[model samples]
Target: MKTLLVDDHEIVRRGLKQLLLEAFPQAVFGEASRVPQARELIMQQEWQLVLLDINLPGGSGLDLLVEVRLLRPQAAVLMLSSYPEEEFAVRAFKLGAAGYLTKSSVADEMLAAVNKVLTGGKYVSVALAEKLAIALGNPQQQALHETLSSRELEVLRLVATGKTIKEIAAGFSLSEKTIATYRMRIAVKLGLSTNVELARYALQHHLVD
Candidate 1:
């Protein structure tokens, strides 16, 4: 089996590689710390599975997921993030991820998720399953954050965590002006006027820490 791991943290990649190696001893692994490096490896090789970090330094992993789908329709792509399932699982599915798992998940769960995807099945965790059930049962009761685009939601989360526009821009490798635009859009969508309002709303809805 051929697999690729894309994450900014070298320790995370090393740790996950160890876990995966335990499960599939013969698996050949590739590591990338940024989107560009991942993209280059994707273009050059065919992978059976790609474990993608949703938040990347130079680009959003969601963006890379779309590209991966186009580049290798048969490749199984699983989204891995530190964020909650409510924050990104639905969007990851919409972007063609075979599965979405939080970094806190147990190694066994991770292996099962990877195996499910390898066999051409979708993997949704118990937590995400419950959220999906709730959303389906109460479609009209969706939170305001649900209405925001993925990028807008990301910016809002950063704002909620007390990150300034400059800090958010640096984290996303985007311009401060672009982040400001996203912040404005988030404000408009959430019916909130100030950054404080945004932060309060996110906290109230449990969108961020």
Candidate 2:
């Protein structure tokens, strides 16, 4: 089996490599710590499984997931994130991820998720399962933030947490102008102006830290 791991943190990549190696002993592994590098690797090889992080340096992992589906339609992509599963998993599944696993999840859970994805099944944690059920049960009661694309939501959270446009741009390796555009979109969607109001809305809605 061939697998690729894409995460910005070297320590995380190292630790995950060790843990996944225990389960996929014969798997050939490729690692990349940035979006450009990851994209290049993906194009250069056919990976059976892709372990992707949600907050990549140059882009959201959801963007990469889209690229993966286009480039390697048959490969299973499992998204990993430090964010709560409820925050991003639904977007991930919609974008064609085979599974979503939080970094705080236990090794056994991680293994189970990987195995399920590798075997042609979707994996969802109990928390995510509950969230999914709630959404299904109340299909019309979608959260306001749910309407935002993953990238837009990410920018909204960052802005809410007092990150300046430049800081948010740096975090995503995007230009300030690009982040400004996202800010406009967020304002237009949320029907709010000013960072203070945005911050207030995010806090009231529990969309940010």
| TM, every model | 0.86, 0.86
Q: Give the alpha carbon lDDT tens digit for every residue of 1-209 in model 1.
A: 99999999999999999999888999999999998899999999999999999768676788889999999898999999887888778888988999999999999999999999999999999888988999999899777788888788878877987889999899778899999999988888889988889889988876665
Model 1 stretches astray by more than 4 angstroms: 158-180, 203-209
Q: How accurate is candidate 2 locally (lDDT)?
A: 0.88
Count of backbone clashes, every candidate in sequence: 0, 0
Estimate the TM-score for candidate 2. Answer: 0.86
Candidate 2 segments exceeding 4 Å error: 161-181, 200-209
Clashing residue pairs found in predicted model 2:
none
User: How much is the lDDT of residue 57 in candidate 2?
Assistant: 69
The candidate that wins on lDDT is 1
Candidate 1: the clashing residue pairs are: none
Q: What is the lDDT of residue 150 in candidate 2?
A: 79
Predicted candidate 2 versus true structure: per-residue lDDT over 73-131, tens digit per residue: 98999998877777678889999999999888899998999899999999999988998
In order, the Cα lDDT scores of the candidates are: 0.89, 0.88
